[model samples]
Target: MTVRVRLFAGAAEAIGQDEVTLADVTTLGDLVARLVADFGSGVAPVLDRCSFLVDGVRAADAETRVTGTVDVLPPFAGG
Candidate 1:
């Protein structure tokens, strides 16, 4: 199945877009692997510090099952 991913912060800049469509991703981890492969090292650091949400709720694990729309949120820095 296909899923919609929304990228944020540095992750968005690395991928050059705010959203993307991923196909045949069985788990959240799989989707992340694909994204790393697609964007290469440019996105690696951010991916390492990222968190995920399915729909609107935080995903607890990379193995979490996902569908429809998800958000990939990279760590944000502030005081």
Candidate 2:
């Protein structure tokens, strides 16, 4: 199966793409590891700071099963 990841803010800039498709990634941890492997270590920090939305719902933890679309959103700043 394939999972689609949508990056936002720093996460998008770090990977140089707003969206990517990954294979063989069944959980959030797997997806994060794959991204770091594919995109290089530079993306790790961004991923660390990101909050994930799995198919439009906030992921509870790294073990969260992932499918469909995953949205990677970095912390936002506003006042």
Q: Candidate 1: list runs displaced more than 4 Å.
A: none
Question: Clash pairs of candidate 1?
Answer: none
**Candidate 1 residue lDDT tens string, 1-79:** 8999999988899888999999999788898889989878678778778889998889889899989998999877898
Model 1: residue 29 alpha-carbon error in angstroms: 0.7
Runs with alpha carbons beyond 4 Å of true place in candidate 2: none
Residue 65: error of model 1 in Å?
A: 0.7
Model 2 error, position 29 (Å): 0.1
Instruction: Please state the error at residue 18 of candidate 1 in Å.
Output: 0.8
Model 2, residue 77: distance off in Å is: 0.5
Model 1 TM-score, 2 decimals: 0.90
TM-score of 2: 0.97
lDDT of 2: 0.96
